[model samples]
Target: MTNTIIEFKNVTKQYDNDSPVLDHVSFEIERGKFYTLLGPSGCGKTTILRLIAGFTEASVGDIYFDGKKMNDVPANKRQVNTVFQDYALFPHLNVFENVAFGLRIKKLKESVIKQKVQEALTFVNLAGYENREIREMSGGQRQRVAIARAIVNEPEVILLDEPLSALDLKLRTEMQYELRELQRRLGITFIFVTHDQEEALAMSDEIFVLNRGKIQQSGTPIDIYDEPINRFVADFIGESNIVEGRMIEDYLVEFVGGRFECVDQGLNPNEAVEIVIRPEDLEITTKERGKLKVKVDSQLFRGVHYEISCYDEDQNEWLVHSTKKANVGDEIGLYFDPEAIHVMRFGESEADFDRRLEAYDHGDAHEQ
Candidate 1:
């Protein structure tokens, strides 16, 4: 049987004289998966984490853990631990003592505490560093120590609140891999909070993209990247060439003064919509043989590919990533497949977006 580890149902959090930090948010977390709450600062990602950790009370709605309501649960009573951003180890304590502090406070036997601390350190690959003082450890070492301390409690869920934000880029990248691997090894639920899109893309089994106190979308990395529900999601998840358009029919869309075939459906005829095409999906070709003619405006060499900017007759700018070079002021053709065009309606709720997608999928299956 599949067990649900955590759930937030219509949860809202508000402070005095300010708007709600989280407005009617709802989601679920399954056991033993890596879930990331991704958004900019003040988008309520941290608030969700705090609510789950029992550090704050929700202004409205209920929270659940393992099918039990947790609205009034205290921090220490919950079976969860947090690895804070600063790796909050005691500066004066050695690694072993630091990891065993919680157990000691609970009046556990000395021998049991020692065994658990040793096991936690070994789990974090720090078995030989028990006697080292916190001040004597590197940043990565300190992070592992924090993980060790948290796991020593044997919590079923671990909350990582941007724990890698303090590390350098190289170490941060290295730790990303390590954290994902550690989660799989432990087979425990990990709820990671981050504003970094790349980190969320790389590590999350599921991602909840938040903005302005609401969850904009939730899905796997590839699902969100390829089929953004709206403009905000498209612009937030990655680089996209989004333009205003109209859905002409089930498989036709018009943008930049041309009607093009597309793979999307379930929109009203001539309904105003936005279209997104990834930069890498566009190819450059001779103007005479291309579907759309564009003039090169600028280009930047981005190591693996050149990011070229072009303008069409309607002055709509398009960003194209390609391996070949193109001269500025030259007219070129932008080629893309019908399946590459993703159509999104304005102000569509997630429920509506999902229903439309279901309709399109059912229609396609019927045809096939």
Candidate 2:
């Protein structure tokens, strides 16, 4: 049996006279997994988080938690806790009292609050900092305190609203690992909201890519990165080399003034499509032996690899990540495998795109 912890059924959020913030969005979140709502500003990712946290109500759909309707449930009544972006710590209180505030509000015994606060602090690796004031703590430490406060409440779901956005790059990366490990240890559902693609990809068990008040795609990080449903998803999830193309036939496509073999099929003859190839997949080689000849337009060292940009005869730019550096304006050959090409049809709905891709994938599996 699948343990679905949260379900959003055609949820929409609209205010007086304004357009819907979330337009008929529907998705299911399973228990004990890290999920991320990822998108740029005004994309409604935060709106979905607010709805789930009971901070805001959905305008046009039902929300369910553990098989119970939550449309009218109060925020305090819901079994969810939130860690806001700013950490929301109390400057006047010490760490212990800040963490104990919720328990104190619940009128728990003083001894019980003390024990739970201690345990929570220890859980977040802040056992000895209970006496420290919030102002004395570092950004990462205060963030942990916010988490400790949430976990001390024993909520079934934890919502993180871009909590690491304020930290330095190194600390943010460290917290990413810490957050993932903490979720696993606690064995509860964690809904993380972030606009950072790398953070989402690193921390989420699954990711929902949102845009224009709708989810463009949802899947495991690998699945979303490798098989984006459309041009927006392809461009948003990671660095992609997208180009206009035409599907010549099953397992074949034409792009960059040349025909190439791909794994996509079931499209109408001569249908216009877009092709995606990751920069890491393109190889640099001699022009005479390469599949495509291009001149190095620019190059930059990206610490781990050289980000080389090349332009083919038709002026279509191809971005490649390679270990070898190339001189500017030099002609170079690029090689790519047939399987690297992914054809996306123009104007296909997300459902239709997913269905067609799944069908063709199953057919390929059967043949093998």
TM-score of candidate 1 relative to the true fold: 0.93
lDDT of 1 by residue, 1-368 (tens): 54888988889999986999998877889999999999999999999999999999999999999889999999999999999999889999999999999999999999999999999999889999989999999999999999999999999999999999999999999999999999999999999999999999999998999998988777789878888867878999989999999999999999988899998887789998999999999999998777789999999999999999999998989999999899899999999999899988866677875565445333432221
Candidate 1's C-alpha runs over 4 A off are 347-368
lDDT of 1 at 116: 98
- Output the TM-score of candidate 2: 0.94
Each prediction's whole-model lDDT (CA): 0.90, 0.91
Q: Top model by TM-score, which number?
A: 2
Q: Considering summed lDDT, which 10 consecutive residues are worst modelled in model 2?
A: 359-368
lDDT of 2 by residue, 273-303 (tens): 9999999999999998888999999999999
TM per candidate: 0.93, 0.94
